[model samples]
Every structure is written in C-alpha cells, then in structure tokens.
Target: MKRTTSSKRCNYVLEKLKLHYSGTSYCNCFEPPWLCPEVEECVWKPESNKSKQFTNAVNTWIDLSKKTNNLFIKKQLYEWLDMNHANILAVDRGLYPVERFFPLEKKGIFNTFLGRIIMEILPPCKNTKGKNKILHLLSKACPKRCQIRNLKEIVLQYATEDDQTYLFLLEVMKKSLLGKYNHCKVQLQFEGRHVFYQMFSYQISQKSFFLKWFENGNHQIFLFFCLKEYLCDAVRQVKTVYDYIEKHWKWSIFDKQVVKSMDNCRKILNTISEREYNLLHVSDWISSIESFLLQVSKQHIKLFRTTNAMGYISKLKVNLNKYIISEDLNVDIRQDVSRFLWEITQRTTDKNVFYYALEVLGLEREVVEKVKNEIFCALDYKMLSPNDLFTLKEFCRVIELHKSTYNFVLPKHYYDKQVLSLKKRENKNNQAIGYICFICNDIKFFLTKLSDSSRHSNKLARGSLRVVVDNDISCCHENNLKFVCGKKPERHVKNSKKKWKNDKKALTRKLLKEKQRNFLSKQCIQTPLQEIDLLGHAIQFNNKMIMLCSSCGNVCMLDPESFKYSVNINCKVCHVSPRDICIKCNTETTCNKILVYNQRRTKFHKAPMCNNCTNVYAQKQPVVI
Candidate 1:
C-alpha cells in the first residue's frame, strides 16, 4: 500500500512539472522507463560522486550560463533563492530541516543576498512594530508624579481663558479629591468630581503639551470660585468680546475674534447645564443678531447706511414688537421704536418680520391704527407719478393699509356737461345757414329746397281757391266740362230670334268689358294716408288742375287764411310772400291784382301796370309815378 501511494505522489509531481515545462521544453515524450527511477528513490537519493562528475562534464559542454540572460530564468533564479532562504529561516526557527543535497556555498550566498534584499525592502521602524514597542517602553518607564507635573505644564501652556478657568475648577475639584470637602459627601459625588475633573484636565493637559502656557496659577482658586459663583461669567465675557468685534472690528478681524469668543463660550457652556448656568444667553443674543442681520438684508435701500448698533437697536425693536403690546409698552417711545422696527422690517427679507409686526399690531390695536393712518395719509399726498402709481398700487395691495373711498375730484355730471358743450361748439362750426328747418324738423329738406331757386318758391308757395262740389265730388270750376258732342243714338233689335242672339252677344261683350273695368278700378285704389283722404277730389285750372290764393300768392288747395302761413323767403324772385305776392315776378300785391294783371298799361305812363303791378304800385310805389 505504501509503495502504491508513493507511486501516485510521484506521478502527480511529474504531471505538474510537465504542465509547467510544456512552453519551454522541446521534447514531447516522457523519459524512458530505464532512466525514470521509482519516485521515492529519485526524491531521496543524493547524486553519487560519479553522477556529479558526469553532470559537471555535461554542464561544461552546454554553456548553461548563456541561458541565464533570459528574464524568466533570472526571475526563476530569484524565486529559488527566496524559497531557499525561507527554508533556512524556517529550519533556524526549528520549523523544518535544510535540504542536504543543495550546495552549501550557493545556499549560503543566496540566503545572505535574500536576507539583505528583505531588510532593504522592509518599512522603517517608525511605521513598523518598533513604534508600538517604543511607546510601550516609555509608558512603563515614566513615573506617575512626573507625568502629572508634565500634564500640568502642558495644560498651562495651552490654557485659553475659558480653558484656564476650567482647569482651575478641575484643580479645585481635586482639592476635594484630597478630602478638603469631605463634609459634602454624597452618592457618586467622588465619581462625579473625578469624571468632571478628568474631562477638563485631559483636554487641558493635551493642549498644554502642544501649545503655549499662560501664567494664571496665582489666582487659580479665585478663578475657580468665580466660575462656580457665576457659572456663565465666562460666557458673558465671550459675548462681550463678540459684541466688541462685531461693533468695532472690520471683516478682517471679525471672523477670527468671533471664532475665538465662540470657542470660549462653547467650552464654558459645555461644562454646565442650563439649570446650573444659563450660558446660552450669549447664544440667544447671537441668534437675535442673526435675525436682525437677515431682516436688514431685505431693506437694501434705507437701511443700507445703518451702523451695527443702529441695526441692533432696530432688531431689538422688532423683537419687542414680536413680544410686547404697544399700549402696554411706552407709547411716548413708540415712534422711535417703530422707526427702528420699520428700518429693520424694510432691511430684512424675513417674512417673519412682517408676521411679527402683525402679531404686535394684533396685541396693540390703537398703535396699529395710528401707524396705518399715517402711512395711508402719506401715500395720499405723495404726488405719485404714473410709474410710481403701479408700484404704489402693488404696495397698497400687499400692505392693505387703507381702503380708497373717493376718486377724481370733479363730479361725473360736471364733466359730462362740459363734454356736451364742446360738442355743440364743434357742430356750430360746421353748420350752414339753411341747415335747419322749423317746419320739416330736417336740415337736409330745407337745404335741398334752397339748392334750387325755382323749387325754393314752390317749396314756400301755398295755394287756396274755390273747389266746386257737384253732389259729393269736388272739381275745379274751370274743369267743369261742356259737352262738345251730342249723345249717340241707341239701337234696338227687330226680330225676336235675331234680337235674342244679338242681345246675348252684346251681353257677353258687356260682361267681359265690365270685368276688365272692375280690374282697372281695383288697381286705381291708392294706399291709405293717415290723416287725409283723396277719395273724391279733382281739380283743374288753366292747363292743369290748380288752386289760387285769395289773399296771398302762396298757392294751396286749402285756404292760406284758414291756417297760419310762414314763408322761407330766400330771394325776391323766388319768394312767395306770406301775405300776398306774385312769386315769379317778385311783386307784392293783392290777390286780385295777381289774379288779373294788366299786360298793357299806358305806354307813355311812368310804369306799365298789369293788374298785380297796378295794385303793387298803388300799395308799394309812389302815387306820383
């Protein structure tokens, strides 16, 4: 069984070698059986003197040193050197034996060279385990008293005012540790003191070791008592320093001082709870200042020139408004206070400022009303230009300070009446003389009649005459017809049959004629007039049916005397006198003269007088003529 196991192991080794050598070797077949020995014998046996002599002879012929030029061969040689050194180290440590078959001189040289390479590649002691050992040794060798003294020196060196104060408190606490305050014994009192002292002491010790020391040992006890008495005193000092820098320092020194003061405040506050000491008062002031700053930022215009103290005052007013009632607060001081508030309100972008203002107003109605009234009154008198109107409108919308109750000063009707008067003036400028007509109530009607001189007279003339009525039909006396032809003779039928037939034909023709006559009569009916009926009126005078005025040349079918007459007398030639006149000849006379004018008068007379002319001469001309 052992032989079988040995055989398997030998085969496995040979397989691994073959796989590795495949890329480098020229041969394909395994070595011959006679040359390949048993695995154990090949692994265990050293080369005999004769075999070594033979290997030396073969090596001398092959020039094996030439193959050492390859990088892979050099790497393999170095790996072999490393493996050999590792084996030597393992054996020196009693972990394994050194191989005897390997040449002693070559092994020694490889091991030494590898050892030197490792030592060169290794990191320095500062980064290695050597650093830990050095720290361990120093810790063990240092005395506790010496360490405490060193810690004290270190702490004093780095002690800030707050840190020194804290350190003094810690030392005072240590006095209790020495049993000075044993009467104040309580549960965990020792533990609490130890914890408190250790906490501050360690920090101070670390700072002292690394930073400069301050001389404050003389008053250490006194400082401790002051801190204990007024636990927030250091915080107050920090606040004072912060306020000083904020008010007096520029940006260059502001941040540095702020950081230093804040750190001191933080250290002091962290040492005590709020109940023990309200050190957060400084923080509260800081927060208030921050809030003020935020508000001031919103008021970019007016508040831009504000000093820090002014800004702080403004912020204080804002905060007061946030908390205090205006009536409850001093009213005499409110104006100044509100000015401060407004400055901050305008400067800040904070919505909370407005909200705070609202809250204040809610608490103080009279003050709010006064402020609102003042603002609205100012807005009213402010001669807001067109550009400013829109902004003012928006401001009013946002603030809603007042409701506008009145608009333009003038009454609406007054303006309307003025506009109508202007329109009348414009119309007068464009009006013509004959544009208006009292009779027709139309400008165009009068203007059209005035455009023609003949139509003008016709338009003005009124005719009146005798209209003869025979039975119910009215006709002109001149139109009464005198029969020029006698009535035609009526014919009668002689024979009964011939008479009947002829009568029938005559009746038929008569019926047809009656139908056509009736049709024509229906077509002759005129559309109805509202107030006048022309049902039975007919007249004729001279060549046409006409009427004449009895008293005036104003021709009309109805009597001019029956109705009032007014003529639009434009020209004498075309004028028809409202009393009596010959319209065409521009002569005024009695109606009788116009009706019967003498065409031939005395030829040698001063005037040849027609009937109308003679009457006009009698009335209008001189009797001498």
Candidate 2:
C-alpha cells in the first residue's frame, strides 16, 4: 500500500532532519506508530523505490542545511521572504526577522529603531533576535504599556545626528507615526538638519496608511493613544521646522501647494485633542511663526495696493489677536506677541492697520504712540489728502473709542491750529475796524441790536424805567409822559399834560418826514425787516414782562389773548411753553418764562427748571425751616 503524510507530519520530519544534521535529535518515543508517517513512506519505497528514497532523503537533508546556511548570508534572503514564510519564521525564530520582511509596517526605520531602543531600555522581552524583533513586539503590545522614556531616548539618539539624511529619515518616520497617533512623547532637538528633516518628513508621511487609521477608523481609544504618541514625538520637531521657515523662508517660498499643505496640517492638528497634541509646546511655536509672518506681510505690503493689502492684513490681525489674547498661553509670551503685532501695524500703510493697532492697544492696554507715529511718518500725505484720510469714519470711530489707551492725538485739532495761523496772516493785510462786542452769554441779542443801531445814525429815548434806541427817536414814555426827540434830551419836562401835547405834535411831524424818507430809501435799499419771518411771533420792543428765571428775561411775542390760552409760546430761553407760566417752578410771574419741549411736545410738558436745579431738587429733602 502507498503511504501518505500530512503537511504537519512532513514539516515535523523536515525539522527533525535539520536538528539531526546539526547533531541534535527529538525523541517522540511514546507516540503512536501511525503518527510517524515519514517512516511509513520510507518503508513503502523499495528497490527502484529504494533509489528514489535515497534521493528523497538526501534532498531533504540538503534543504535543511541550506535553510540553516541562509541565517548567515551577507544579504539575508530572510529580509526578502514572502509574508507566509515570514509569518512561519516569526513563530519559529520569534518576531525580530519577521519585521525586517515588513519594515514599512513598523512606522519606519526611525520609528523601528526607536521601538527597539525602548525595548532595550525597558524591554518587553529581554532576548530579542535583532532590532526589528523589538519593533515587532512593540507593535503587538498595548500602546499604554510603551514607556515615554524609551521613546524620548530614541528620538534624542537619531535627532542628535548631524547627518542630514539620517535626520531626514528620522523625522519622516516620526511624522508617519504621528499621522496615525495623536499623543507621541518624543522630544526633537532643534537643528538645521532636524528642521529640514521634519518638513520633508511631513511632506512624505502624510501619504502613509498608518496615518489614515486615525482619520478613517472608529477605534477612538486606539486612535487617541496613537495620536498622543505621534504628537509627543513630532511637536518639538514641527515647531523647530516652523521657526526656521518663519525666519529664513521668503513669502515667495510659500507657493499655493506649500501653503495648502501647511493649512491641511494645521487643520489635522486642530482636529486632535489640544492637550495631547501640545506635547512640543506647538501653540507657542505657531504663535511665534504667525508673528514672523505678520512682520513679513507688513513689510511686503507695498507690493500690493492699499485695499488688497488691507484684506491680507485683516486676516493676519485676526490671527495675531487670537494668539495674543489666548488664555492658554503664558502671559509673557502673549505680551511679546502683542508687541510684534504693534510692530506689524507700524510697517503697514492701510488705514485698517491703525484700527487693528487700536484694538491691540485696547486689548493689551499698550501705549500705541510708537505705532501711531510710525504710521503717520510712513504715510503719503500727498497721495491721501486730509479729507480723504478723514473719510475713514470707522477708523475715526475706533480712535475715539480707544483714544486714551492708544494715545491718539486728534488730527482735527492740528488742522484747526494750522488754519487759524493762515487766517492771522490774512488779517495782517487789513485795517482795524470798530470794536464788535463778543456775545458769550445772556445779553447776545441786546448787544447785537446796540451794534446795529450804532452803525446807523440812531437817536436814543427812555421808556418806563428802561432806555431804548431807534433811528430818530419818537414817543418817549418817561414818568407816564410822552415826548418826541430828534436828538439827545436837553431838558427835563415839568408838566405831564404839556409834555404829552408837545410829544404828539412833534411825533406827527416826525412821522410825516420819516414816511417820505423811508419811501425814498426803499427804492434804493431793501428793508432789513424784509428777511425776517414776521408770521410766527410778533416782535415787541417795549413791554413790562416779568421773568422768574433770569435766563428767560425776554418779552413773550406770542399773543396769548389772540389765540386761546392753550396756544404754545416760545420763551426767551428758546424753550416752548405748554402753559402760561414756567412749568418747572410753577411760578406765574409771566408767560415769558422758559419752557422745555421735545419732539412730541404737545405731549407731557417737562418743568422749566435748569438742569442743575433739577438735579439738586431731586437729591434734596424738605427742611423744617
């Protein structure tokens, strides 16, 4: 009968053959004979079968010897073994060589080396076959079990290398792993090689599938731990790279692709937990970078027009304010950030620059004099006229709101002073005229009337207890007697009846003469009264109107008796009266009292008291006295 052997039996035979050649043997003495299928197969092959058996035995021995010999090959074929063979070898020899066959699976060489170093320092299993063995073991081990010290040591070892290529590879590996993990704990030492390595590593590592796991998988816990490890490893390196770029790279160096890539990276970083992703103090580093970029942007603003540059600057200002005011950052760092923003404002010409500077000053409570001076010094006053600059109403509003903090000096004040100086120069060319009284307060109208009368050849008269003036005075009512005078009083009247008789005769003659003169003057010069709107209020030159408040000491022009007593009247203080007397004091001295009114006037009338009196009365208590 033909003999058959199971694959496991065949494998057992082959393993035994290898041991036997090396002077070792396995004794399965107590096992059943049926299990020894190789022995049965050997017995079944006889004669011609004997020749085949000898050949088969020799070939199996040779194959086992060759397998042993491959372990020491200079270019070990084990590194190139297929997955199935590698898995089998991993089970037999352990995971060390197996990882070599799948080097890309373990992050990268840098990550693998780091994994091995960790294993060496706090090894999962002490006797690893090679560096790759430790990596393979770490991959299978729980992420929480991974020691932070070992990760830090691996990063430091490779990061310490001055070689650009080695550093680049190290960074690439770190970035690749960071894509998958959010909270890595590696500390990258800053150097030129390291920065370049990090940038390039980020460029390449974004494409890794391990990175996709964090993005695509539902294993939130696993994803978080992986991300933690990666961020811990990459944050310091990323900051170093950005710092170098900010200082050394020009704006032109940032093409759309690079900027887009940077934005994408930022977005991805933002998506991760801030606590975990901040292992390298990346927020501080990014703030520094933003500050540098803001400076560059401000310096290059001349390359763009005012409007376009303003748009760009607005975004920078927003980012800058966010950084400066972020409570998560240190106070000193925020201060520095604020200073940098101020510097950016100084270099910019856009009007919004000052607005942003104002906001910064408001936020930081900074003295913005330097920024203001710089802006004014660099501005093209010729290009932008005073009026044009003033047209930025929003800027003016901001200045008004924060002028104290920003130390904003009003431009209008300076302009007015300049204009006054010019007016003085013009006045020097003209001769002095008669003094015109400056009416500051209560007697403005009377002073204006006196000045007008003096300009004409007007005569003066006396009425009741007051003196009045007119052109060619007539109808004087002094001591209840009337008299007409073409000139100043020469003598006093003794009899009241005779004074009235003489005044009537003189006034009649004066009126006839004045009418003739007025008609003649009317043809040459229009009457000043023609411009006055007489329909509203009747002008009364002489009336004994008593006023409770000195401010309301003018005659009531409205005829209270002509219309009903409800007729509205404006008082001397220009207040509208709802009632006949002062609404505030409720004093009935005269209807000429000042009245208060608003737009909805025929509405409830407010009291006619001054603001000061009202305030005092509101706070005062009635005295027993």
Candidate 3:
C-alpha cells in the first residue's frame, strides 16, 4: 500500500461514471449484458438528484442547436408556437439559457426548457401522477428575481404549435402558481392570434405576485383573455366576425347594437372556457355550438331588423313621430283606455312591446303626439325633469328615434347651468377685449373720485370691494354694488340716580302703549250673533270695507259696525249669496231639493240658493232621492 497509487474518486464522480458506463452498455459489444446495471438504475434519480432528469430533458431540446437542420426546425417550430424568434435563438445560444433551481431539501424537478418539452413527450394517460409530474417540472421555472417580462419569455418558450399545449400549460400554471401568485402577464407577439389572456382569473391570486406582473410591462397587451377548448372552431368563426365588427362597425352609432348582438357569442365562449379538464363529450360540444350559433343568428336578425328599419326611416327623411301622427288620425278611444295606455307607457320598460301594444290598441298616433308635445315643452324650457326624457328614450327603442331629436334636450337645471356657463364665457371674452359692465364702470369711477379726494385712502378705497367686469345682463346688481359697513362697538353707560331718570319720557311711553292696546282690543271685539269665517279676511278695497276670501278670490261688502266688531269678516258671495242664478240658462231659479256631491257634506255652494243652480255649480249635480 505504501508504494501503490491508492487514490479514491469523490462518491458523486464515481456515481456519475457508473451511470455513464451503464448507459453505454449497448455500445460495447464485448461487454456482458448481465454485468451492466439495468436501464432504470442508469437513468433513474434519487430524491436528492431530482434535477438530473430535468437537466437531461432541457439539454436534449437545447442541444438541438448544434445541427443546422435541427436549429432551423426549432426556430420555425417555436415561431408557430406564438413565440418571438429572437427569444428562441437567445436561449439556444445560452444568453439566458434554461435555468435549473432546486431547494436544499425539497423534492421538485427543474424548470428548464426541456422540462416543458417533456410534457408533450409524456402526454396524460391513466397515470394519476401525470399532472403532479408536469407541475413539479414547471414549479421552479421562474426565479425569485424574475418578473412578468421574463416570465413571459420563459413560459412562452415552452409553447408548442398546438393550441391545446399552450392552453394546458396555462391550466397547469393557473393551478400551481395561481395560489402562490395571483396572475402572470402574457403579452402576445402580434394581433389576431386568437389568444385572450385577460379573461383569466389571475386577479384572484396573490397581490404581490400580480403586482410584479402588472408593474413590469416592457410590452403592450390587451386585457380580457379566453382559452376556448370546447367549440374551438365555432369560437374561431365568432372571432372572425368580432374582428370585422371591431374594425368596420361605426362604434358611435352601433356600439350598443354590436354589444347586444355579441352577447350570445360571449356566453358560448364562457361556457366552453369553464371546462378546465378536456373530458367533455362530443354531443355536449355540438349542442353548445348549435345553441351558440342559434343565439348569434337570433341576435343577427334583431340587429338587421333595427338597422334596416333605421335606414328605411333615414331614406324617407321623416321622423317616427311624423309617421305615426297624421291630420286625419282618429283618437276615438275610451277615456279609461287612454288613461290605461298612458299609465302602461310610463311603467313599461320594453319600448318595442309598448309600441306593439299601442299598435294593437290603434292609439300609437295619439300617444306619439302626446309624447312629442311633452318632449318639445321639456326641451324648449330646458325643464329639470327627467321624466319626459326617460319616456322619450323608452319610446325611441321601439321607433328607432334619431339622436338629434332628443340628445340636445338636457334637464332643466343642467340647461340653466350650461347657459350660465356660456354667459360667463362671453363675459370673459368681453373683459379680455376691454369691455366692462356698467355697474362696474360706475364703481370704478366712484373709486377714482374717492382716491382723488384722499391720497392716503387709495389702497383702502380700492380694497373695499372686488370688481368683476362681467357684462352679462343677468348678473346680480346687488352682488356688484355692495356696501361694507365698519364695525363699531357700543359704549356702556351708567346712571347713579336711576329712580330720578326721565320720568316724563316713561309716562309718555306708557300712555302710547295704552292707546295701542285699546285700539287693537276695539278692533278685535266680536258679537255672539256674528258667525265666524275662518277663510276670509277684511280688506279696504276701492275705499270700502270688504271681506276677501283667500281660497276662492271672492269679495263682499262689509258693514262699518260689523267690520269694527268682528274679529273675522265673512264673504257674502262665498258664504251666503243674496240670490242664486241658473247654471245652464243663467237665470234666477227657485230651490227644489239639495243635491249632494259626495259622502262629505261639502256642497258646491255655501249659501242657501236655488237647488236648480246645483246643475250650474256641479255641472248637472244629481240629487239623492
């Protein structure tokens, strides 16, 4: 042992040599097959060596760049996978080559490029560990320092030409990292890629993870993504239509129409997208596609119907109201029916249904005319009420009303505010051009005079009031011309002989107070025979005393003695008229019987007049026999 070169290699190097030797057993024809370790022993790794297989897989994909044909194939393959060409070459050249991370005592695989490649190599089968294995490989792909931009590059490199693979990768990422990190930001290379990433629930993940994705954006991307697996072909078709609409449709005019029309398409997408695991039956997909197309067709019909109606009306150069209203239009409907229709129109949400109901009742013309008049009155006065505008909107949905007719009409307060704004703008322009309000000019002249009067009072005179040169006629006069009073504190006075002070003055004040009390007491005196009238007050009209009724504006002569004695004067015309006149014939009539108007004893006339005049007052008041 002293003379011999007794050297020992590290256990790791020894194991590695053994592994390499076992792998090359087929290369050595002279070697005994039984002497070589099994294939499992050669490739299989312990928990301590989890990244060994992961590194081999990544190296297998990464080493392809050594050959030109394989490199070209790899480039084109990744390009079709919705990956940037430059990114592939950079990773292939080891400029940010596939990285492997392993925890000190954890049992997880590497997150290298071929770790993702192994997913396609080992597709899902009856094996339960398939998902766990896929996730185990992808768990550590992103390092602690990695952000969304780099994450996009790393994750997208693993994408394949197949859409299902990208979707599956997204699913795996969503399940694994979604809990740890809310979402990842993925920027597409180009438009029309049929990739919708915003719609995914990445927002529901951890704020720290999402913030990292959201904050670091080296690229621009659209929001709202979708991963359509079921009815994928139908979704593509819908996407084509959506692109056309988005590009060509006049958004201002057709925004609501487009949104309404595509509701069914959105529902279809949502239904298909909910199935994370691809185990749906063919019948299910077919049924979903059929309903989706059916809904789309229905919405299409609705949109076409509305647009065609609009176009026809536009070409005719007439309004919906003009079409409905006519000189010869007969509105001979029942009063109750008209009332009912008005109530229904106010309450009805669906304008089309309301219009249809109006058409069925043959009252569309009357209703349209009424609504048109209300809208005109509201708009002309700029009424602050939204009731009429709401009615117009509800009616417009059924009749395809033009925006020009109703858009200019604002609520009363808003209209006034805008008018005031315009006036203020005009005033500003006037001020800028050296024009000023007359009141402001007058104040300026007065201030100059005051300043000239006292040289030292110039600043004080100028500081008295702020002058705004608004030339608007509606500007408040009081606002511009205000008087500022100086504050003066009252001086305290003390009298030593309080009892001997001003005896004559006190006696005069007491006599005045007694006279005032006597005058009011005499005016307030009332007799027992005099009836009280609560609704009327005495007034001197045309130099004569008269009792004025507040409720009905009737006046009656009051006797001087009654006026002095009565606390409240009663109107003879309203309370007890001297005579009654026939209402229909306008002639004096005699009373036959009293006509009761209602259960309450409140009659049309307050005085005992001819009951035949009941028809005159109550307009044919029926007598209760």
lDDT of 3 at 472: 39
lDDT digits (tens) for residues 1-625 of candidate 2: 1233333433454344334434333122111121211332221111233233222332232233234543222112211121123322233233322222222222334443443333342222343333443243233222223233344334334334324323343344344322222222111111111232333334434434322332343222222223233323432235554354335432123222223333344443433323333244434233333343333333221111212223332333333323322312222212233334434544665765665555543422222333344343223323432322222222332232232122122244333433343244343212111111111001112211111122221111111111122343243233332211112222243553455566887755454444433322322121111111111123232221111111122222332221233223323232323233434455432212133344444443444443334454555532111
Query: Which model, 2 or 3, shows the larger TM-score?
Result: 3
Q: Give a tens-digit lDDT track for model 3, residues 540-592.
A: 32223333222122223444223232344323222222244433344444343
TM-score of 3: 0.17
lDDT score of model 3?
0.30
- What is the C-alpha lDDT profile of model 1 across 1-625, one tens digit per residue? 2445334444554454345446643112232211221221111112233233222222221222123454343332222222233333333244533332222112121122222222321111112232222122222112111122243443343344345333343443333222222121111111122232333334434645323312333322222222221212222334544354345433223233323333333333333322232232323212222333334323222211112233322333233332222112221222233333344444665755644554343324443343344333333322433322222222222332112111123244433433343244333221111111111111111111222124444434321111111232243344453211111112233453454565877765454444433322221221111111111221221112222222222223322122333232112322333334443354543233222333455233232233545555566533332
Model 2 spans with C-alpha error above 4 angstroms? 1-101, 104-218, 242-625
